[model samples]
Target: MSEQRTHSPQEPQRRPRITHNRKKTRRSKAAAALLYVLFVVGLSAVLATVGWIWANDLLALNKDYTSVIVKVENDESFGEVVNDLKKNGLIEYKFLFHLYGWFSNADDKIAPGTYELNTDMDYRALVTNMSASSSTRQTIDITIPEGYTIDQTFALLEEQGVTTVEKLQDMSANWNYKFTWLKDLPLGDYHRLEGYLFPDTYTFYLGEDAKYVINKMLVNFESKMGDYMDQFTEESQYSLHDIITIASLIEKETDGEDYGTIASVIYNRLENTGAETQGYLQIDATLVYLNGGKVPTEEDKAIDSPYNTYLYKGLPAGPISNPGMKAITAALKPENTNYYYYVLNPETNKHEFTRTYAQHQALVEKYGTANEEG
Candidate 1:
């Protein structure tokens, strides 16, 4: 028998190298470290997201609006102009707008003008609109003189690019303009806005409709005359028709308030000539209204309407001009005077008042024929 080594029972059996299990423990430790690192990175990312939200909410932009007029040049670069706006404090955040335009390829289509800008404008839209020759909105100022008839008022508007004079003339006969009071009244030729329209300085936007202008004038009339409608309460004498008729004469006579008294003198003659001879209270103003002629002939006197002082023995049919407050006040409260006839001093625009026809005729002959005044 071969010699067999017999170990003592106290000694243990040794295992192979592959079964040691040390390497396995090391691999597991490495995997756990990697997982821990990944979890830390995810937590950091979540925290950063929360902080960004809070910062954005706290830092909103606030800017005041101002109106400024700018003239754009032909061939000017839009980018250069946007840079100018940022530099001038006219716009906020110039970069985002410029980038948006560059990305969208809309850099060349901006409009330039006096702009009313506020914080309401977005970065991209502000740049897009501010960069050319177009406007978001347009504004204009209109001035209507104190004594303009509707036709004359239209001419003023036409001269200022508001509308054509023909449009106003056409509307006088249009169905819409046929007022409730004058709807059935003929329009061959008539006062467009007599008691209905008012006179005052006003402001308006560009491209306003003709009807809007008419409405504005009417609104003014309502405001000023709302309380004074009953100014002529003694129904037997002072009527609305008479007040407007006298007011129109006052408007034509002079712009001076003092002339209100003189205007009253002429009205008295038209209403109460003191005799029953049926004499005509001839005035050149009606002829001017009818034919735009400076003077009236015997035929103009035969216009044959209630408006004709020559045909009738009283005041004319209606007002000839849009009167101001002074004229209206004078019409309501005429000064007590015995004068009946008057004539205008062409150079002074002042009238000469007299009580008798002979006195008035002498004044007329002297002023009407004497060297035509200096």
Candidate 2:
């Protein structure tokens, strides 16, 4: 009864004091978890930054290395190209390129075209260039002569310090290149370097292989011919190889643009009355070709070879030389005029066109004699 009479209000008890050791432990655990998360995040960031730099720092420092990328448009695979790049010293990191391509989902979508890539290209620019549909490759201004034979072309290459004739011959021997027009050739041998070595100012590089040169010439030939091959075959009742054969004849006839009328004259001769077994194309150039590209003397005409037009009566065995687009076009559309004989004015290196054989004979007399004594 006495205790109940006091009836004092109860006070809330204070929480128990936290131990110093416990506080330390809790802080240490939280700090360790935060540190682990930070370490993981840092590791992830570092992995993301892989392939951000090229090993060749000087290369990266010198050029913009952006926008321009060598895009390979062939059916070649990425791994093959990567290996090529490594060999070419164009790529410093193979795995990184693969990673970049995979991350960008462009691994299988690489476009088939040659592209020029500048150095210092980032991951984005790399993929962009590789994914483009087409790209222009670096080119060298290679000039093939009007009547340059395959061997002559190789010789020119050797002279330019590009490659040797032996290497080219080895490549040709190693692989047989058969074209559509090859089957139409007499001996099934039209494709080698017969009509495709287009005479033009092409662009090439220092490390360009023979295949690259051949492809460029082929592309140029295709561009020039277009639909003319089929049309010429239909109109002249000759095969595409035949058209090129005539074009090659025209190329050997003259060095430059003057061959247009000469090309027409050849057709005219074929259609004329003095035709000798498919019109004995008594081309002096053929004799010159047969005489190891030397000016043939009267005695050399007796030599027998399929390439000698003076002896054999039809197109030569193969293209005597690489002809330019002008020569090709002239072959496609020969002139309507009919002038059988032509003599190059020695002073001008141009031919005087004459329709009648008497006029030709008179000019020959005026020039000197029938043998071209010069």
Q: RMSD of each candidate?
A: 12.1, 9.8
lDDT of 1 by residue, 198-225 (tens): 7776664334455565667666776787
lDDT per residue, candidate 2, 1-374, as tens digits? Answer: 55556668999899987799899999999999999999999987786554234434323444433443353534468787666555544556788667666776766665544556656654455456555442333334667876677778777765664445666555544544455644343432333566677777766543345555566677677777787756744466766766777888887776465667888778776666463234667787778777788877778878888877667766777667777777777887787776777776766767787876677778788776643411
The true-structure Cα RMSD of candidate 1 reads 12.1
Q: In order, what lDDT does every prediction score?
A: 0.61, 0.65
Name the candidate that leads on TM-score. 2
**Which candidate comes out best when scored by lDDT?**
2
TM-score of each predicted structure versus truth = 0.56, 0.58
Question: Could you tell me the lDDT of residue 360 within candidate 1?
Answer: 68
Clash counts per candidate, in order, are: 7, 18
Off by over 4 Å in 1: 1-135, 169-190, 232-236, 255-257, 276-279, 297-299, 302-306, 346-349, 369-374
CA lDDT for candidate 2: 0.65
